[model samples]
Target: MSNMEDEYDFSHPERGVAVIINNEAFSTPGQEESDDRAGSSHDAEALDTMFSGLGFEVHRYDNLTSSAMVETLTAIADMEIHSKSDCFACAILSHGGDDVIPDNTPGAVLLERQDYVLGVDSGVVLVASMISIFSDTRCPGLEGKPRLFFFQACRGTNMDPGVGVKVRKTKVNPDVGPPREGDGAEQTDHKDAEEGNVDIEDSNVETNYDSDIDNTDSIPLRPVLSVSPSNINKDILVMYATPPGFYAWRRDTGAWFTQSLRTILTPYNATYWSLTTLLTHVNKRVAVWYESSYPGDTSMNEKKQVPCITHMLTKDVYFRPKNMKHSTLV
Candidate 1:
């Protein structure tokens, strides 16, 4: 593996991006529904803090039309299919189903299958494909930059209660550990500081203290565990609002996770934290705020909503701009 620090670049054309899609309205059968702009304004300010000077030009747009969704993505992807450019990051806020959004446009822009996966993912392959267009043509000054996506919408129509809190990391007792050296470890995902990511392995990274023997397959399948080769997009990271089979909370007037996300990014100037560290703080802030908002709501106290971060960064990311010195990672 290449050393993460060695991947740094002094000149980045675009610092990075935080595309916030506040879908506050939807078109339905000749009818239109407006979402809360108050929440949108709140979330936009939050995302802007994270995007500003992160390594790309910060662009902001209101809820897009159904037709505009695909078209907009196509147009932007064309800008940097490949080259040593700044990274890509986006935040989507909308009423969601399985994998589609009801943009305020005429026809609801349905998403592709690959985009349905967890963590700031959605029609991302299409965006990645667009990046390939530039790379294939050997586009000058725009290749190898990471593409990060942050999605804050429900994956499916269904909504079930989610596990909102964790007293601590769950673990198995050593007394119950299985005894055997060849048993190997189970497949798992783990985080590393240098790479600023949580990587998946063919074998689980977590330990089952109850089992004395590791249960993982000794044979390495780098190809299987790594992000599919079919996806050439490199250094990508996605941070999602919640997990499957759960409700990503939103108030009639405010977006729960989004509001907190902005709180962390905008104030105190925290741009130096890595992707993992950012999410870790995000998870904490979101959970704490949710708990406080509904003081009387019992279920709220029990459940903790965390941002599901899917990271694939090359080098460490700071909580604040590397060039600028900030006392606190806001």
Candidate 2:
């Protein structure tokens, strides 16, 4: 692991960019708010503060429609500034679900919604399509740079039924424990991140300008081959608020996952821990936070959640601020 860390350059690139797509209110005009997402803004603000403290230039988009989200991402992908940057961090905070799509024929298969996070304008946009625009094949400037994605949304409707434990309240220490060190190499799909964006469709937004072409007219077909390995987007990290097929817990103050993240990434803590170690701590903290808010239903009272992370990074990652020592304690 030490040898692996020695192989890469950790010099600060020109300027890193952090993009925050924050969706707070999810209702359009004439419709009641389907979801208020009470604490998303808190998450976004924390993320912005953290990334900015790490020297990233933050770009935030709030309450965007699905089409608007696509347009925004597309515009970012088309920008030529990535080469001048060292890394990119994207945080998406919104209402998400795996809504079922009914087949046209009866008794046919019901399809699960893929790659979309719900937009405020009641539109569903393909998250894959949006991110693919930044793929190495499409956006060459970002090649080899570390890309980070943080998603704070429910992956599904299923809730965890936590096992009963003896009730005992103790006076716990207010300070965080000393950070731990661990070596586990591998990256997550961020592909799931691509599949989680959902929004509504607007027929009025679609328009076509076309003319018939001659039958004799032929365009040469070219076959393109990919050199990269399958299911891998190298040098990227994806952190989800919850695992697939689970609900992400939240409070009026903010989401449990984001709060845990902020706590772990504090300057004092980050100086002593690697990103992987910090994330593991976050997962544990979130998993142990059992919710008991049901008024009369004990079955619904015990709920738990854990965060999911996918990374393709081949080197150690640290989040120390500028002028801080790069030598990691791990």
Candidate 3:
């Protein structure tokens, strides 16, 4: 267990706000209702229950357009309640892909790619642009407080064929540990051969539009105060549904990442585990316990996914017990 002083103080009267953005329908100019995401509501409801049980004020938004997404997030960042809260969290579930740009080098034919999430209207919003709204210079109320962002969307259309692992049978002994080397053991591939249907967050037909249509440019600018830019990005954590250029899977139940997250961060578990520890457990659950079973598509069958987590948190974070009374810890 970590010392109390090492953990971010979660004892403030307000635990914090948790914003959930669930985009299930798409109605872009050329898109059909068939492009809508299914089962995203399950994720939203699970997140709401989990965060609300953790004492957070949960606010859920559904089917927002690109401009509405930016507006909603910007308003949350400007909320005065943040000044009295201990942390902040936001989760976005929608279709996502890479933002491609023409390489400008002379005679270059390659394209540059950046990560972005799509709004219901199929508008593009860079992931970086969303994080910038909560920078220390912009959202002063959240300075020095942990800010968590969770994205459940595909980064691209690539499928992951998991690597093979060697399995060995050996005698068990109390003092003996697992072998470090394979020792020429036969390798076995683990794949889910069951017949089932799964959905990828990527669109079947790529939508084309002017790159200048990105809605991030229209984000309302806040007054820039004289804060050190050095730590503008401090105390932030971002978790993506999948690695770059990989697909995120969903089913009738919910998204794999979100279901695993909800399972691992139960109210009881939150009391004993640090937030990072919980997330690691979530990573393992999603990576090992789940796999695509779309037998109809051979290429997508048995595919695997691993979530990506990046953080700049300076200290450990712990969620307070539900029944605990509030008191300033620092």
Name the candidate that leads on lDDT: 3
Winner on lDDT between 1 and 3 is 3
Off by over 4 Å in 1: 1-10, 27-38, 53-56, 80-84, 99-142, 157-233, 266-271, 291-304, 319-330
List the candidate numbers ranked by TM-score, top first. Answer: 3, 2, 1
**TM-score for each of the candidates:** 0.56, 0.71, 0.75
Candidate 1 similarity to native, TM-score:
0.56
Give the alpha carbon lDDT tens digit for every residue of 1-330 in model 1: 123454444245346444566555443354354333334455566567556625446667776654465555556655642244555667766544332223355684542222232111222223244334334244443445555677666543323334333334233111111233532231111112111122224434321112111110011111111112123444566666765434465543345566555544431223333445556676765543332123354444223355556655677554335454333323
Better of 1 and 3 by TM-score: 3
Each model's total of backbone clashes:
49, 16, 0
- Residue 204, model 3: lDDT of 35
Q: What is the Cα-based TM-score of model 3?
A: 0.75
Task: State, as a TM-score between 0 and 1, how close model 2 is to the true structure.
Answer: 0.71
Identify the runs in model 2 with alpha carbons over 4 angstroms from their true place: 1-8, 29-34, 99-115, 165-232, 290-292, 296-299, 325-330
